[model samples]
Target: MDDGSAPAAGGYVLGSTDREMARLAALSEVYGPVTAAWLDSAGLRPGATVVDVGCGPGDVSLAAAERVGPTGTVLGLDAAPRPLELARARAAAAGLRNVSFEQADVTRWRPPAPVDAVVGRLILVHLPDPVAQVARLAGTVRPGGVVAFADVALSTRAAQPELPLLTAFNAWLLGTFTRSGRPVDMALRLTGVFRAAGLPDPVLTAAAPLERGGDAVGWSVVAGDVAGLLPVMERTGVATREEIGPETFEQRLRAQAAEHDAVLVNPLVVGAVARTPDGGG
Candidate 1:
């Protein structure tokens, strides 16, 4: 893997204490089961080995362990130790000896053996070289091993009308990430990454956005949130508000929260599965 210069190796923006990550988990809990199901359906056996990349808090790692049963093993790796510690604690609480979590930049890390499946959720987007990383991941799969991944588009558009301010804010937010070269569009371009890395074409699937109302409403509760992202967006000209009226965002959040049914929209998450050149099932 040539240890390509790592991008924010251990500085992943999504941290345990970050409010945005907290809200994201709340929403993604409902959305991620679909992705987990696909991973479970692919290359899983009583003794299969699965590698979960960017395995934050080991939710998917533990889940994969359960799916593969005690006979199988799940190794989840991440660049950050905070998430790994949480993942370890979770596994410990569940007595999931089959699952292990380690901390290392995946770009410089390699698996001890070719695994049955290599998976990552919302990982590649943060990478400086998404294509190269995908290729590197392909190298970890056993002959005919599977690679499954999922991510979302930067923009979460909806047919339903939205507050003009929120709509504009969302648009600016998308550009902010894109300018930094980590656009959410990676959700769909995974096929390109695979092809560019010379891996087999994948079977792709999608899960559409589901509304998340209640206390979770407002931009603060979405992807990056405006506060943590405002500085970056402003520097890049992705967003510029003339004035942020006091508690305006808070009021909007409260309003949306009250609706409880305010339909939140997001791009469909695209998931893919592919095999290595060899036909080892």
Candidate 2:
């Protein structure tokens, strides 16, 4: 749902701090349904095998395990070891024996064996060459396997009544991403990226929730991200801790939302799923 995964060459702006890890969990909760729908659209079935790239703490990997059932297996790969450890614990706690987590650089990782499908969420945005990476991932699957990915589109953020604080934070988030050299609109470009990856144009879906008032999950999602990104925002000159007031950010967002009676449309997430060509092209 929210940010995860470091680039193969390193520098994932959202560092792997405890605060960031908690933020990622909150984000997964918010984005879980959307990602579930994406996996369904990818045609995961019982007995299918899947490899989840940049799986973070295995939220999506665990979901895929449920989808593919006991007979199926899931291998989740990420560049960070701490997240992988968390992912392992989560799977263990959930009693999901079918899913496993591993630590590896996404660009350099290879499947131990050909799998039914390859999937990722909120990962490509961190990569320098997503198209080539997608192509490589596609090749790791079986002949008719699926290649699906999900990413965020920050430009789609809006507010019905226009809460001032929400608007300001949205701008800060977008600005930070832009200045940090991350494509703020990777979700909007999935089609082109998939096609350029030498795969067919994917079936695309976009989703965003209109979170209303202070109590909504969106508030926490944004606040958590702001907390995680505070350092980057400061280093990149996009924003400063003093200016952002991380300690009061969530409170301020809730207060403004309550004051304005607004409904905030969270960032849009775009998902794309394409099938590998026959004969494993």
Please give the clash total of every predicted structure, in order: 0, 0
Top candidate, metric lDDT? 2
For residue 182, what is the lDDT in candidate 2? Answer: 80
- How well is each residue in 122-157 modelled by candidate 2, as lDDT tens digits? 999888788899999898988878999999998787
Task: Give model 2's TM-score versus the native structure.
Answer: 0.93
What are the RMSDs of all candidates, in order?
4.5, 2.9
Candidate 1 off by > 4 Å:
1-11, 212-220, 234-251, 254-261, 279-281
TM-score of every prediction relative to native: 0.83, 0.93
Residues 1-281 of candidate 1: C-alpha lDDT, one tens digit per residue: 11222224323443444554465555456566667766755657778899999887777788789888999999999876666877898899999999998888787788877788888887887777877888888888888788888777767554243555456666766776766556667777888888888887888877765555544433345434655455555566666645333236656654654554455565667777777788544
CA lDDT, candidate 2, residue 7: 27
Q: Point out where model 2 deviates above 4 Å.
A: 1-10
Candidate 2 lDDT score at position 126: 85
